[model samples]
Target: MAYLIGILITIIILLLGYIGVIEMQIRSMSEQLERRLKAHTRQNISVQLVSKNLNQLVICINKCLKAEENLRLKSMQEEKQFKEMIANISHDLRTPLTAIQGYQQLLEKGELSEEQRKRLAVARKHSEELKGLIDHFFEYAYLLNTQPEIKLKRINLTGLVTDCLIASITSFEEANKPLEFEETAPVYVEADEEMVTRIVQNLIRNSVEHSEGTIKVEVLSNKEGILRFINPVREPEKIDIQRLFERFYSGDEARSRMGGLGLSIVKLLAEQMKGNVTAEIKGDLLEIKVTLPLAQ
Candidate 1:
């Protein structure tokens, strides 16, 4: 009886030791997986112990990792190809557009009947609009392909917005949209000057082009500098607020010419400057807000 009891005790001890070894191996594998994922490495999780079950688990995990890595590489390649295609298309369109504009300028210099002059004026206007569209596409592609050099500095938000509005006054008048803005106290933010200027200009242009009624602008400062643009739209229900910043997503046929690249550019530039942009519909009004870090 004593010998039998001793053997039973030894078997229990061995069983517990086996379980402990399996637990440690699992923990090591967990750590290896974490390291591999964080470092984005091609290294596979390896096992130290000789267990069939654990080896199978490692194999499955390695297979999953390989699949994920392949998907990531494929996505990156596709995006590069898409950007290159856009750049090429924009470049190709610009050459012919430039020649057309040059010919239009020559036509403008020559004499013409009243009706011909009117038709020429209309052609010039549409050609200018087409040129603007092409330029937006080219700029969008350039922005995606290269990282812009940002020079961060303290900027007067109120003054910058005011300047942009003043510069865009003629456009607003031409669109017959009344502009409304109440001057507030000076607000300051830390951002890239050129980027912020572009953001403001793009927002203003968007409002001028799309607003059905009055266009309003406001600037406020708290923890961050807030620049807000409010405008009335004819059909708020048709606007997809969520996809407003998506590349090439236009909410309406009128906006199709630019392909929604203007707001997309604004969003990208704002994010690059450690800022953010949001849009929402308030009743009949569409409000777009841009927030940037306040100056210290």
Candidate 2:
């Protein structure tokens, strides 16, 4: 009876020993599998387990590895296709659009009656709008498909905002619109100057087109660095705040006149610079806010 008890105890010890060895092997395999997946290597995780339970775990892990590999391959293929489509749109479409603009300019130079000249001017206007639309499409496509190189530096927020506002003032003046800028203390942020310039330009363009009354630009130093554009609109209900930043989303008939890439580009560029943008509508006021990380 004692001998049989000893034999049973030895079998139990061996069984526990086998489980410990299997656990160690599984831990090592898991670490190796993680490294391979992170390196994006085309390698399957394999394990040799004598026990049934461990073998089942190995099978589950292998299935996950296969699924991960398939997802990675599919993402690569989709990205490649997107780039090719953008290339085709840029080359094939823009070339002819450029030619059309050139001919339109040449036609403007020729002599014509007053009515004909006015009609030609309208044609020229629409042509210019079309050109802008095409450019917007190209820019949106590029921003979507590729990561733009951003040169980060300490930018003077007050100075940058002032310059962008000044550049846009002429357009507002020509439209017989009153534009206001409330000066703020100089604040700095880490940002790419060119990209920030684009962000400001797009925001101002949207205001020039849609804003009705006083257009105000201000820089606020708060929890985050904020550049705000406040403008008065005729009716606030016409604007869809939620969909304003979405690509090709024009909330109203007036906004539909635009190519609808302005706000989308602003959002993309802002995020790349470690910033974000938001819009608020209160009463007839439409305020667009761009917030950036303050320079440390």
Candidate 3:
């Protein structure tokens, strides 16, 4: 009986040891799985920094993929819409051009009175306006499709502002809008020359077209490089300030048909040049501030 009890005790000891070994193996496998998962996350694109992060990482990635598919679909729809818009615009333009040609033929063949010639000139001017509208449409479309390449250089901000002002005079005159610029020292910063110029010009035009009161452009040296565009609002603006960079967004309902690529293109170019854009309202003034990193 003592031998039997001893054999039983031996068997119990062996069972405990076997159990311990199994548990250890399980623990090692768990640690290995964790390590591999972390490594895989580091290599993958879909991983997001969530605190409950591991579990949700896969979910976030899936969501991102879904969102990307949606965006591609949306872009496809926009392409189709643009094609229709172009066809309609082309048809509208041809009507005016045809009228101008008919009038020109009549003027050339007959002794038209002064009044008739004047009316023909007016018709020609309206036809030119139609052409101008088409040209503007093409400009926006081109800017939308073009990829920006930033060429960094040290530029004089004040001088750039001066040049932009000079270019805008004629544009403002045609729009029956007055433009004013406030200046400061020649602040130097690193940016793409062409892009900066375009940004300033667009902002100026947008402000002029949308503002009810006088427009003010102030170039001040702030942290790095800052350009501020300010204008007094006549009508309260309904636009979400956060959405100012969206394409075809305009504050005034009446001006919506002017159909601009101005702010949208400016935003894109600014980002490509490693700059930032933001807008705000102070009292009756609508202010847009753009900041760029200074040249080392």
Candidate 4:
């Protein structure tokens, strides 16, 4: 009986050692799988193990990893196809749109009766609006499908916002919207100059289009680059600030047909630069803040 007990103890010890080895292998495989996934590799994941249960667990994990890899490949293919389609459509439309605008200009230059001139001006106006919508569509498609390499440099946020506001003064006057910009100390950030310009232009344009009162842009130089745009909402209660950054999201159903890519693009660009953007509606005041890492 003593000999039988000794044999059982030995078997138990061997089993525990086997399990410990299996556990260590599993941990190492898990780490390797994570590294491969992070590097976006196509290597098959498999780990040898002694215990039956552990072998089964590795099998399940490998199946999941394979499925994930397949899905990733499929998504990448679809994205490439979609980007190509957008480029082709944009080029096809731009060629004819440019021709139409050119002819419209020539027509405006030619002699015409007062009624004829008014009709031509109306036609030109609609054409210009169509052009703007197409441009937005192109931009949205590009921003949504692909991540472009941005040239990051130390840029002055205050001066950039000021420049955008100054350039938009004429439009503000035309829209009868009072524009105010409070200049603070120069807030510099490491960001793509062109992206910063686009973000500012889009935010200001969004505010100008939606605001009921004055549009105010301010720069706050803090640990993070804080560029704020303040505007009074026409119906603060109805606006969903959370949905403002969603692609093709509009405040109202009436404006749904209007291309709503401006703020969405801003959010994407901000995130690509490792920055953040948010909107808050307090009573009637709408504040949109864009924060980026401040350059030392």
Candidate 5:
């Protein structure tokens, strides 16, 4: 009976070994299949990502091409408008100038008596006025397109303003308008002196042109550490204050003949020197203010 029990135990141990071998083979095959499926999924995901990026790049390129085409069309339209303007300017000026030249020649030839020559002189004066207007147009247009090269340095505002107003005093002498200089203490600023002078000149001219009778100039400092010069306008219009900075805004049709770019040039120069110019129309006074950075 003992011999029979030993043989049965050996048979059971052999069966267990065979079962373990079959289980290990099944696990190996399952691992290999999983790895192949993972690689296939990863490759598909990479290809999809590449395709999406390609679509986005294609859209960006299309937008850039369309923008280039639109800009070209706009440039052509502006060129056409400029040519038409030049033609119109020539016609407006040539007609009056030609008439004046013909009348002057008749007077010079002694074809007209003294009294008739005096009448022709009136025509000549009107023609000269028209010619001056045309010349002003050319100058203002040139200034608009070409910039004056700036040489920057410290500019003394106290002396500059005093001198400018003194030079312009005779211009307003008839009106008995006195220039009220508020502050005379030397206020120095760091900027192009020539440009600043031009700015001040234009401001003074505008004040004398538009201001009632009295022109007051101030170089005052506020809590914000900004220095400004203020001028009053003579006649305030119903037009918006912002419109004064625009080109070709005339204060009066009879008094003003130029394209009204005096203030506009002042505005352009002020901006170039890291300054800002603005205007306000009170009930009757038009106030212009220019703010410039103070030199440390």
Candidate 6:
């Protein structure tokens, strides 16, 4: 009876020791998982214990890690390829576009009949539109490929927007659309000057192209400087407010040609300067708003 009792005691001690080992192994695995997640490392989980269940768990975890790494690498490769493709296409189109513009300028300088002159003017207009489209494409591709170096400074938002609107007066006249801008007090913001100018220009151009009636501009201030553009759209139902800022997104086929890249560029530039843009439809009107941080 004494020998049997001794054997039982020994067996209990061995079982306790095995359980302790397993607990330690589990703790080590947990720590390893945490470190791997924080560091984004490619290391696989490993177990020191010689238990079949623990080994199987480790195997499953390692497989999952390997799969995740593969997916990440694949996504990176695809993105690189897409950027390269855009860059190449933009570069290729630029040469021919430049040549076309040069020829158009030469034709303008030559003497011709009134009918010929009118036809040349039409051709010139179309060519200019094409050039603008190509320029937007190139700019969009460049923005995607490189991180922009933003020069942020305290700028008068009211003055800047006013200048942009004045410059766009000719465009509005050409489009046979009226523009209304109510002057407000000087609103100051901390933003990149060039980017802000681009944003305003793009917004104005979008309105000129899409607005059915008078285009309205307003500047307001709360905690941030807000620039608002309100325009009556022809078919409000066609415009998807949610996808307005998406690259190459357009509400209709006609808009698809002229509206490509403009809003997307505005969105990207605004985000780079720590600003935001939003669009909504109210009745027959489409209102777009841009908000920037106020200068201290």
By lDDT, the best candidate is 1
lDDT of 4: 0.84
lDDT tens per residue, model 3, 207-249:
8778776677877776779888887776555766887777667
Which candidate gets the maximum TM-score versus the true structure?
1
lDDT of 6 at 73: 96
Question: Number of clashing residue pairs in every model?
Answer: 0, 0, 0, 0, 3, 0
User: Model 6, 118: alpha-carbon shift in Å?
Assistant: 3.5
Give one digit per residue, the lDDT tens place, for model 1 in 113-184: 999999999999999999989988998998999998999999999999999899988998889999999989
For candidate 5, lDDT tens digit of each residue in 1-296?
89989998888888787566555544644454466466632211111222345446545644654575578779988866664575468557778688868868777788777888798888777777667566545545555556667676777766777777778888668556667776556777767887777788877766665666567787754421133434444445644576778766876653356557677777888888888888776677666787776666
Model 3 C-alpha lDDT versus the unseen true structure: 0.72
- Every model's TM-score: 0.92, 0.74, 0.62, 0.82, 0.60, 0.81
Each model's Cα RMSD = 2.0, 4.0, 8.3, 3.2, 17.2, 3.8
Instruction: Please report how far candidate 5 places residue 85 from its true position, in Å.
Output: 6.7
For the record, the alpha-carbon RMSD of candidate 2 to the native fold, in angstroms, is 4.0
lDDT of 1 at 215: 93
| Model 1 misplaced stretches (Cα beyond 4 Å) | 1-12
Ranking by TM-score: 1, 4, 6, 2, 3, 5
Q: In model 6, what lDDT does residue 50 have?
A: 87
CA lDDT for candidate 6: 0.90
Q: Candidate 4: minimum summed lDDT over ten consecutive residues — where?
A: 252-261
Off by over 4 Å in 4: 51-53, 106-121, 140-151, 234-243, 253-258, 271-274
Better of 1 and 6 by lDDT: 1
| Deviating ranges (above 4 Å) for candidate 6 | 1-39, 45-58
Clashing pairs in 1: none
